[model samples]
Target chain A: MALRREEILESARVLFNRWGTAHVSANRIASDAGVSPGNLYYWFPNKAAIIRALFAEWSAASTGVALAGLADSGDPGDALREFVHAAERQPAATARYAFFPRELFALLHADPELAAAYRRNFEAGVDAITTIAQAGIDAGLLIDPAPRANLRDVVVTAWIASECAPAFLEVIAEEPASGRGSGLAGAILRSLLTDEGAKALDERKGARGHEHRGIRAG
Target chain B: MALRREEILESARVLFNRWGTAHVSANRIASDAGVSPGNLYYWFPNKAAIIRALFAEWSAASTGVALAGLADSGDPGDALREFVHAAERQPAATARYAFFPRELFALLHADPELAAAYRRNFEAGVDAITTIAQAGIDAGLLIDPAPRANLRDVVVTAWIASECAPAFLEVIAEEPASGRGSGLAGAILRSLLTDEGAKALDERKGARGHEHRGIRAG
Candidate 1:
């Protein structure tokens, strides 16, 4: 007779993305999910908990999907290429995925617990990208002297920006590259990878990718 | 007596810093400023209008201040120092001043009048930055095959990123620099401004700054 935890989260995601975390109340979420507030609370202790759960779910899914794309491939750079192609289909979901700051503003200011959790989640993301970059370097894939801190920042930052740009460009229009994150990611990939790495990536789909060519020649 | 419009905007600035755009409503704004919704309505048509008014007010003040700091100096690049310093203090205002995407989303999508206004407003902002970049080139302070389009797009994109970063970072604390629109503004300034421009910019106090210098170096 009661809605499942999954149902509640699915409904909450819809509402949270549309209305915002601040405007959506527990009652509204439960109502949208076709459940009572008590049931929603049973699964998520509070709105903050719901948000945390949502972040954990999306983070695991996004990172897992991206990483999985890279796992089986022989060429780490190509794996990353495959990963980029996979991330493009879920534009709205990706856009929603990146819309945390509006909600985070109040939570981080008020709740130490939320802030710490947020810090850990993002650091993990950066580390994930760092690991991928390290692998590329070890395999003789990437260039520009693999600087750990900077490259990690670049990839993780790119992941977040790529997710946000769709909705953002839905309004501003000029910001989105035709390849979405792929082009930017490729540019970043080229920036950090070696000549062999670049060749491998360009030949990922067995074509000479032009992102590498677009870099200004000075 | 009704609350004065300037007083309302200034108070809204404080509220925005603390509560953000979503959590705080016209009702709270009216009450905080010791007026009624009706009184506030006389000054601002809606919550978004209040936000828009604040944007205009803050942009007018900050832009004028930054411009004056530049104009008084013979060297345009030197003036850009004031611009950078101006940026650090101004993030709080920038974050508060723009309507958060969630709030801006519907109006941007549906309201034709607001959409046109949005376009004009955005174009104006881009034009201002382009003009600054052009002036440096004209003075032989900047090196550019084409100053106007290049500088404007870079500035517009980066400023939007900076404007949007706090919200994005609030959600994704792991990547604070994700939406930093102006992150590349200085680099564009440096790359386009040849030796003469760099010399001029160097003369200004606090002219040179970089959060991730490596992002632009490659």
Candidate 2:
């Protein structure tokens, strides 16, 4: 049952990403999944239920990768760089769930249960970012000169920019692939950093570049 | 005829803003406009046509405000400030057309003519911002040490943040009014400013504060 459910979700994700949720009907999803409508319904009550499940899975996977990156890095700058890179990669990582972000507002407004779940996930994401940013500050690798409330606002703003800007721009502008990495988060982070923090971040980037070259040479 | 067209568009905008474009039907819009369905059709062939018209009007108003602010201000810093303020106020200014931003991608995808118009407007907006940023640099009020491409990218990112961040966050997280002024654009702008630029911006802000106080006292 679990395996079938996963298969159904995978099918739905592909269709949703390709054509969006509104265009793809439940029967189409079942056909795409190579399952009878009755079988698909047995596994998932409705398309909304499938979307909810996919959203939960995507959110968990993204948060898990972010937390893992944080846990693996000892240096605060390195951790932050890793976390941001992970976030930058998230759109591609969950491309199957592309429909979710594009239709996010309408979907959430339509389903209270989904909205509540999404809100919890959003809060968790914010908390994780706050923790990482605070750690950077503690390690003397970040400087936020704003008052407490203002600093929090800046962090949240940076978080939103990093997580949503690329995807949002992609959908709205239909921008070329070359236009993808605006590095808005990096710009925001630079504004928040002390000189020491800037140096540390540069050093971390240099080290990562060297590691990448070493791997390529090997 | 034009007056009735305006009335129908206004009615559709309100309904769309309240309940999204997909859920609001043509008949509902016609009823809300206090017009017959035939009359509504005479003005706008369909709901998409009405949405496109509203979008065009909203874009024109926003771009006009930004350009007028730029043209009026002698100081680059002042111009940038005014532009940001105008952009920030846009969501509220066009609140009745909120569905356009929320469903931007889908709407553009659905209509090539609308997509072309939007692309032109977006490019014009970028050009205006770039011109203002360049003026700031020439006046020694901004420092963008980045290469030409990177500098353009940064400006575009800041523009997107200023224009879309509040509306996007409100819809996604149901964030409070306190969260409204994340000042993402301000942060990005600060990062791009030279020391002199930062000081000039501060002085301008201080002067504006005094002006506000003087107005209140008078």
Candidate 3:
């Protein structure tokens, strides 16, 4: 199948989420996917390349998919709910999405081009969030109308890391994860929401059954 | 000379923050401290022992320091600020605290006891946050009295990680010189302060020589 490469990538992501990049060797990935490690190497040169691919793929789907669906919504509160619901759909898949965001953030330690690309995508998502937030204000649903620096990044980045539990790295004495938040997106949102926006989300309780109750938005 | 152990542990904490335990061999820590690795091993059996000492020492100090300070403060918001600020001061030293935490949650591939300890510490911190939150509600500073679940961990963990920006990790992709948001803790505090709290902070802006023009804290 033309999508075989992507499939391997997908499987690699699964293994990575479960085993981390270190333990889930290419040989293991190949075996899990019913291919040879040699075949895996034919596509990816080494462990680092596979990790890079996983990160790139996650960034593509996450920002693009959620923002695309949320773009048309006039109310930022509704848009945020849609996004949360989307994230909640797959506990495992979403876990995959949350899994490596720490390492992805850590790319700044050694690589500039990679960091720029990450910030660009992150900024793009933030822009979309800011736009929707503006809409909420114009629609009488949001409190503040201004775009604060790193507003979305500060919250969203932390939220993703929390969902991933990057703070749990000390047991293995790891880095980067310590540097990131456990997940404060929802709390940060609460601080920024309009009285109306907060009230609206408050009404959605017990609805949608999304399990990401932490992002209660209020 | 009696302070040697504390000094060794302190030096280890710094190296742990930048290099991570796996990357920082005993020699690196010894050299950084201007001591021999042989002396280091004499005090602690292995790096893991040193890791445990760091956690035990920090946990005891942090858990008691601010709680003692805020014991008489009726306002939970004030206590919460004290708590967060205390954490902000030792962001680097605390990296060792999060070293295993990073693995337990982010990687989810660490030893069981480490993960268990992480959960225990995390829950305790959550309890502390919730206690203050409840106090805030009782004091009439907070509107909603009920915390859905883990509101404290989600909020505090996110802020610290985003703000600390650990070494060897790419999580803080933005350039430090850019001076955006001033790490997650300050950003979160600014983002989540109650309207009243924001006003309190803003009232001092002129005298403090800091501007809060567009910063939303409701």
* Per-model TM against the reference: 0.61, 0.82, 0.71
Model number with the top DockQ: 2
The deviation in Å at residue A8 for candidate 3 is 2.9
* CAPRI level of candidate 3: incorrect
Candidate 3 Cα misplacement greater than 4 A, ranges: A1-3, A73-81, A90-92, A97-116, A145-195, A198-218, B27-38, B57-69, B74-81, B84-117, B142-170, B175-183, B202-218
Per-residue lDDT over A9-111 for candidate 3, one digit per residue giving the tens place of the 0 to 100 score: 8788888766656567888887887777777888888766777777687677657644853654744666755654444342334455554644443434445
Worst 10 residues of 1 chain A by lDDT: A144-153
TM match of model 2 to true structure: 0.82
Fraction of native contacts, model 1: 0.05
Candidate order, DockQ descending: 2, 3, 1
lDDT for each residue of candidate 1 in B1-218, tens digit (9 for 90 to 100) = 44378777777877876666657888888888877788899988987787776655655654653454455355455445455556556555555554443244444544555556666666665565556666666778655433112344345444444444555555544333323443422333444445665555555433245522411110
lDDT of 3 by residue, B2-59 (tens): 4778778878888776666668887777788777888888888777677777767766
RMSD of each: 8.1, 4.6, 7.2
Best by TM-score: 2
Q: Per-residue alpha-carbon lDDT of model 2 for A8-44, expressed as tens digits? A: 8989999988888888898998898888899999988
